[model samples]
Target: MALEDVPRLGCGRSIDEVWAGIDQPPTGHEEHCQYCQTARTRLQRLQEATVALRESDLHDPELKPRPGLTRAIMDVARAEVRRGNRLLVRTTDHGTIEISEQALDSLIRIAATAIPGIHSRRCRIDIRTLPNSPHETTSTARAPRLVINFRVAAAAGIDIPKTVDALRQKIRTAIPAGIGIDAGTINITVEDLYDV
Candidate 1:
């Protein structure tokens, strides 16, 4: 890999590859390359920190993370991948929240505006598309999963988690049950807490 590729690796590179260069030291052109040197230094520091943390006897729940932590981490990481260059997502809210990554912003704009709720203003929702693998042969399978992110009125004395959970259930029930098409994954992100 080119020297420039080293720093661009971010956290994606394998630890072995990183350590190999750091331990053995790259010769010739690589020795003079600043990018590789910086990457090596960063990797070494990260390794040291990881080792030190592992050896520490601290038992903080935050550091250890609760169960399903990996799943949560993946969710956040996947959102970044889905967001890409798109900044706003809109869908036509027609008493039902039908959201998907494809034409997401436009669809959210339509859906949210149709719903009646003054406090529901300024709701931003992002839908991520999840494609079905080729190995799975389902004739009725439609598009990929859609992850929805939105903000709604929270101060309506409503149970936020229950409401969100109900909304998700409604989406799952209505989409395939009514339309007979698998509606991709729906992820809802509540951006702002509103007082209703």
Candidate 2:
């Protein structure tokens, strides 16, 4: 289901709303409602994880993420409160491992910025799930194929085709290496140019 289509808790509050008010004092309904309390607790954990991840990334000198990357990471973290559109990474007898779409977007942005002369603008990920073989077991279920639509700005005087090819190759390799998920079709658009 789409993020917006995801159902609200019994208290009628979306997780997004809860996250927005995470720092505020709890309302009477929130204090008494079990669903609201649970959502708040879980969201707080997610908030902590986001902060930790940001700190680690910032301290890693080799990463050198683009300017405003921290803000972008927080924005994605906030949007992830809706918790929809997760891609399956693997399946086992124990359970399935999934990664959020926003996390993948952040990974893509970071990967794109690693290529010199390329700056990521925006990206969207779509997934197409192929039918499983009739004999295949649940533990070995196939993951949905990922199709990425990425927009970027290139440094002036850069060879557009060559640099973009490098960008594509970077994304293709990075996704699998970073998250253990294979990237499928990648459509890149050089939407703007920036001075180097």
TM-score of each: 0.29, 0.55
- lDDT of each candidate versus the true structure: 0.53, 0.87
The CA root-mean-square deviation of candidate 1, after full C-alpha superposition on the true structure, stands at: 20.7
CA RMSD per model (angstroms): 20.7, 20.7
User: What tens-digit string does per-residue lDDT give for candidate 2 at 81-143?
Assistant: 767678776666778788888889999999987899998988889887777787765644777
Model 2 TM-score relative to the real fold: 0.55
Q: Which ten residues in a row have the lowest lDDT in candidate 2?
A: 135-144
- C-alpha positional error of residue 99 in candidate 2 after TM-score superposition, expressed in Å: 0.8
Global CA lDDT of candidate 2, please? 0.87
Model 1 stretches astray by more than 4 angstroms: 1-143
lDDT per residue as tens, model 1, 61-100: 6667689989999999988766544422222223323434
